[model samples]
Target: MYGLVDREALLAKVRAQMHDKRYRHTLGVAESARRLAERFGADPDKAELAGYLHDYCKCWPVEKMRDILVRHDMPRELLEGEKELWHAFAGAIVIQTELGVSDPEILQAVRYHTTGRPGMSLLEKVVCVADYIEPNRDFPGVEMIRALAEQDLDEALACALGGTIQHLIEKRKTVYPLTLLAYNDLVSRRDAQGGV
Candidate 1:
């Protein structure tokens, strides 16, 4: 079990950080993460906690996120890359310094939830996929990914990440390297297991 956590306090802090719409999304992700973790053998509490805190800095000014990334010496690629990805990296640090979250798994979950990396833990995958299939999310292909998640987490994530990559391509947006690597890792592992 995780350490004794102040759930109400944490929720209050998280709610104060985002707008109404995003707060609803965060709640959805927390519920979805809890469900996914129950099905996928992750710690449901950790997954839900990660869900609530994942977007802690999502509504912050890009300059503020970039400042934290710089002062914390986050990877140069992250600092230089898309601002959309900044919240995940910056949120992990803020939760620790500001919210007193010290668990490595929760921190990593928040860090990689936006742009997944290779060799992700089960909790990480749960939080990441939950972000996609949360009830508040209405993106195309989400239902298919949700169905896939019930059967296989890797395949579900592969489908979701592939969709993300293709969408980026269609919009002429740059796909982060770690996203590609995470997709490849899931696909390769599935192939090795004789799955498509």
Candidate 2:
């Protein structure tokens, strides 16, 4: 199992690698993750760690990311999409191999932070929702989503997934199948009163 990284070192590395805007986003994600952790009864330290490193590969050159994906034998389906969305998976690998983040929960949080999966763990939901509704995020209706997160996590996730699906459709972008499945799963779970 991988051990936790030194907090200061990890933050410094993230700051040095990310652009100023991205650095701010990381800070926002960290704070949001911490809050969500507290609300959901998750480990704030792990949430913060996962949030800090979730985008570690965001700024990597496309070629480098592709190379890493190739080395890892990542599914061609996963590699077929836009480069913008590849960072989540790529970042997970980097966090595991480069940053020594071995915790499965933390790694999974980073992995699915972009394209959510069905039956998400609490930590995963926390990181995913936090990334979307962080203070630095200024998308339309973000405040409302943030409020929803505080009230009902499943509702917030449904909203976030719906918003993402709408955005993708409006942009004429390919919607990853996993995201749709995740959205449906969340809606179904909520309707069935299957609490997370």
Candidate 3:
């Protein structure tokens, strides 16, 4: 079923949704997602597609994203929390309704790419991590996350989530609950592994 998606058509649609910089970032994320998926034993194709679709609504007007969230009856927490998190959830619905994407895994990946949830799938982890470590991304700890990604996906993602939480704290911005849950889940899993 995944094989049937028109790659060029989808790419064109994704490209149309953002400015040149974001489109370039999307491309980088797609390639990076494919690489991460291969390294982590996930479906490379699904990872790439999710990467392309992940930010489909990122540059849209806040009002537009809010409208979609309201129509979809998204969680009140999400609706009230950071607007930065809206794009992922709204993109999931937009891709399905407008772009004909029906794969649950891919949709889930897009939905959680920004604010990762507890018990994320490998594909979701791939896209989320790819978004952070993509070539266009240049935050302070990105290189460390990229390095950790090469060795351990969970470690890399936990580090990335930690960085995000810290950044939000520094900015006095609200930290989304799911992101904290995701980070804690990774930490707990590592602890359960006897601190390995």
User: Model 3, poorest ten-residue lDDT window?
Assistant: 1-10
Please provide, for model 3 over 14-114, each residue's C-alpha lDDT reduced to its tens digit, 9 standing for 90 to 100.
Answer: 88899999999999999999999999999998998888889999999999999999999999999999999999999999999998889999999999998
Model 1, 21-134: lDDT tens per residue? 999999999999999999989999999999999999999999999999999999888877789999999999999998788999999999999899999999999999999999
Q: Cα lDDT for residue 185, model 2? A: 89
The TM-score between candidate 2 and the true structure equals 0.94
- Model 1 per-residue lDDT at 162: 97
**Per-model TM-score on C-alpha atoms:** 0.96, 0.94, 0.96
RMSD of each: 1.6, 2.6, 1.5
- What does the lDDT come to for candidate 3? 0.93
> What's the lDDT for candidate 2?
0.88
lDDT of 2 by residue, 1-196 (tens): 1245666777888887779999999999989998999998989988988889888989889899999888999878778976777889989998889877789999999999998989999999999999999888998989889999998887898899899999999999988878999899899888788655
- The parts of candidate 1 lying over 4 Å away from their true place are 1-5
